[model samples]
Target: MAIDPKSFEAIADLAYRESGLQLVVEKASMIQSRLRHRLKAVGTDSFASYAELVCSDEGLDERRQMISALTTNVSHFFRESHHFELLGQKILPGLIDKLRAGRRFRVWSAGCSNGQEAYSIAMTMLETFPEMAKMDVKILATDIDPKVVSFGRSAVYPERLTTGIPKNLKDKYFSVQKGKEGDEYTASEALKSLVVFKELNLLSNWPMKQKMDVVFCRNVVIYFDADTQDRLWPRFHSLLNSDGHLFLGHSERISEPSNAGFINNGPTSYRPIVAKR
Candidate 1:
């Protein structure tokens, strides 16, 4: 059944309120298509009924399910090769020195989908600074969707999805698992041990206690409004340690990079500037 304009608007408003995602009119069809399965699962025949349920207090779990269904989770190992290169060559050297000097090293992969980005960070760090495996180094991977968080925690992917990964790294970091359906690659225990995956909503309060040395929030802010993006820039700056790096998607930019205390180092990369005492 086609969703009515009223139902679409209600869903759009709810999505924006909960996730800061702008669901314009053009997305109405996409929204309806995505929610159809939810309606079926909930035993509702109409969009209006599903929308009402989702908006009610009793629908909290259903709301989470809806958001998970609608979110985009397309990611692969080393999606942006340059960022990894920069990390390995320019950033890791300084961070490694700090690690050896008894400083904790932390990296955050916000909006990490299915663990690839976080694992890539771990792989790069391990490959560059092998001694890091013995140090206090951790990569935090978070997503709003619980399913993807669970998927990331599992660290399993189809063999075909491993194509872009460097062959040498693949040989060292992944174990091939033969499944009934197809060949699956699981991240080695060493690689998986370096990352922690959790579910986090970006607009909500962050639970992290330690400041991060690098934050990868790529391709996430584009779904939000300009105001929301503006609010996040300062928050990211505050969360970063001195001279910590922030990386965004190719198309995403810090609206006021300088005012936000970010120094543009390269395309989609910024380092937070420490204020003079």
Candidate 2:
């Protein structure tokens, strides 16, 4: 069944309002085409009927699948290379110097998709902060999607996932296997064990016991509307330590004003205004 442009606009509007994904108007044809595939499974040809299934139908199982397909999850090891570089050079060293006597570092990877980014953070810490690894250099990586969280927590990956990863680091942190194509790679247990993965819905109230040293939210808030982003900032502010750092995606910078209790380290880097005693 072909989904007409009118139906595409209708559903896209509903989805954006419901999820705040801000799907561009250009995605109409793509949405129409993807929804059409699901229609094939249900043996339907009417766009009106398909919209109903997506709207208030009993197909929660299938609807989640649709959301995953339409949502972009393009990520990789060492993506937006500069952010991780900043983590290595500026963030980690400064944190260590501050907490060297305490010998502790706690970081959070918010919106950690498929685990590559989270694991990359772990790898960076292991390489840089090995001396204090015995302490509490823990990383809490969270994502809303359960299925991908499971995949990420498993710490397994295909060989292609290691494309930009350095050979020395790869050898030390990942083990190659004979997967379906006779070659596959998985993150080493030693490195994978350093991370703790959990299910998190960023929209609702959070239950964090402690503030963080750094928060790598990256590209997530871009999908949300201004109100959603506005709501999210305070939550992150509360979750981060008074002097903690926040790292946003290169494409998305902080929108809230300075008096909101955040100070800019640079364009993409932000720090919390220290709490007075």
The segments of candidate 2 whose C-alpha lies over 4 angstroms from its true place after superposition are: 5-10, 41-43, 97-104, 131-133, 275-277
Clashing pairs in model 2, backbone N/Cα/C closer than 3 A: none
Worst 10 residues of 2 by lDDT: 61-70
lDDT of 2: 0.76
Taking the tens digit of each residue's C-alpha lDDT, what string does model 1 give over 107-132? Answer: 99999988899999999999998888
The numbered model that scores best in TM-score is 1
lDDT of 2 at 58: 79
TM-score, every prediction: 0.98, 0.86
Whole-model Cα lDDT per candidate?
A: 0.91, 0.76
Q: Score residue 93 of candidate 2 by CA lDDT.
A: 81
Prediction RMSDs, each to the true structure = 1.0, 2.7
Model 1 ranges with Cα > 4 A deviation: none
Residue-level lDDT tens digits of model 2 in 1-277: 5667666766777566544567666766777766677777767888777667767767565555556556566678888777678788887887776557775678888889888888888888878777655666788888766777898888878877666788898898888888887677888766776789987767655677888888999898888878878877777888888778888898877776475679888768888888678
